[model samples]
Target: MTRPIAKPANVKARTRRRQVSPSLLRAALVLALAASCAFAVPVVLGALRPAQSADGAGLPPVQVALSGLAAGACMSLSPSGSNAGKTVFIDPGHGGMDPGVVGTVGGRQVLEKEVTLGVGTRLAELLRADGYRVVLSRMADSSVTKLSATDSVAGAMTASAVHRDLVTRTLCANSVDASVLVSLHFDAFDDPAVGGTETFYDAARKFAAENKRLAVDLQ
Candidate 1:
């Protein structure tokens, strides 16, 4: 204890050794520069863009072409005379891989997609008999997006899939020049005791009043 212990001869040299190698340092710097350029390029290009459309005269908006349907995939009923020319589009929500809400009744399984399709098809048949041109978004248990040929371009992202499916339904309505669109869906809740029917409309849409009236009538 009286004599102090001597330090190692190489202690200073070991402490001075760099933890990071030269190649590693250079790689980190390169990655940083790449990230910076990636972020900056989009902003610079946007700033340089012209104010007007590329074409001298603004071009018409592109419309998605309707795709052919599988055998008995969709139902279209034409009116006889009274309500002729009036078109109604019916959309049954959820299909294909998206089974939608699931429940059990009387020891049997029930899927929202199946129920919606059944009800929607029956409603379409009734509407047709009442003299209205009716179009079913999907007569079979498949997604509207999958029925469309353009769905291949829709990315694999979940949000993209949802958007494409919804857009496909709207395009179908537009193609038929539908006077009204009836979208059928079944709601689910955490509480098993709760059950009801509800209708909703987008207040910001141009047809807000008409949509509201339709909701009230359904209610």
Candidate 2:
């Protein structure tokens, strides 16, 4: 028609423009496939996942053994050598105002609370041997120990004010920014003949791997 005016773009340019359409179509197809695959990925992964039991496989059970270490309220780690870096809190169950369970034998009578402090003291000595800094909730069994017990509140209190005071002292002394408090308590029962040893710790709370190891060692 009117010689098509003198075309600015020649046949080659027109051919190139036609080629571009296919490339754009291919790109669009690829993006669509990618989007569909993205949606399918999670579902496919979920389906391939293994089924799990409500109760998972448990860790191997452990038995504690303390052969060489001494026994008291609890044996302490050496605070001067291997124990130098650690701060250990040792609490002797009952003292002073609280003379825990009284034992009756044929002719001998033993006091639970008094005996615990004796053992705890011996234990602390052993811990000091290894290099650990040791602190006792109470230094002795007397009126002063009772004073620490009743120093807090009014006369109205729990079973053993002395025991409560010892715990208070331990928590107070060990509350340093990062410290481990090990409260030592002896077992008491209706029967005087029943006796055995037990140890406890919170490995999670105190970063207390060392304490646990010590306990195992002393067991």
Candidate 3:
């Protein structure tokens, strides 16, 4: 006979965090970046714009001003149209069996996968039109890696399958010798009022400084 493991304390009282999914914040960021690409300019010089909350209310002016200041620091990085010779890798987060955070808009259900794919695809198109070679992790509503029969268990993605899929995205970027890799994701909280742009970078990576600088510019 085996004993059942006890659940963590306060599990019932804690507010559940919805899985991070694409939101208005991400859509704003991606569209802004895409517009920069359309101008054939380095992304740092792009203008920053205010994003709306979940309820379509505008963000505070202070947040927009701060983002502008962060972007200003990128002016020293590159000259105009430097991206023409670069290869960019765009990874649209979550797909296939993973719907990520399911939220509602206009009283209708919206899937994170759909939002991410739309944003990523548009970004790729704009970059390509500006003479940058772009590679996407997945071009459709499917897994980045070839799905194995055992990839899913009990209607959820298996741990190994998740790992394999993520690894494959990195491998795809590496294969193309990508100049910049942009993995897009949106955030969510239990509170429906939350909404804002976010950018993340690995501080421990060798290119940490560069990554951080780019993140700051994007944010």
Instruction: Give model 2's TM-score versus the native structure.
Output: 0.47
Off by over 4 Å in 3: 1-83
User: For model 2, where is the 10-residue window of minimal lDDT?
Assistant: 29-38
Model 2 misplaced stretches (Cα beyond 4 Å): 1-83, 142-167, 176-179, 191-194, 202-218
What's the count of clashing pairs in each model shown? 0, 21, 0
Better model by TM-score: candidate 1 vs candidate 2: 1
TM values, all candidates? 0.61, 0.47, 0.63
lDDT of 1 by residue, 122-212 (tens): 8776776566766677777777765344444443226567677777776666665567777776644433333334455544555666666
Tens-digit lDDT string for candidate 3 (99-178)? 76666666577776788889887776666556565557766777776666788988778988888777766665555455
Q: Which candidate is the best by TM-score?
A: 3
Residues 1-219 of candidate 2 have per-residue lDDT tens digits of: 001111122111111111222212211110000000001112212222122222211211111121211122222222434435544555665565455445444445555457767776776667656655554555566322234444545543354654545445533333321144444544333322323333444344333555455444433
Instruction: Give the least accurate 10-residue stretch of model 1, judged by summed lDDT.
Output: 29-38
What lDDT would each prediction earn against the true structure?
0.50, 0.38, 0.51
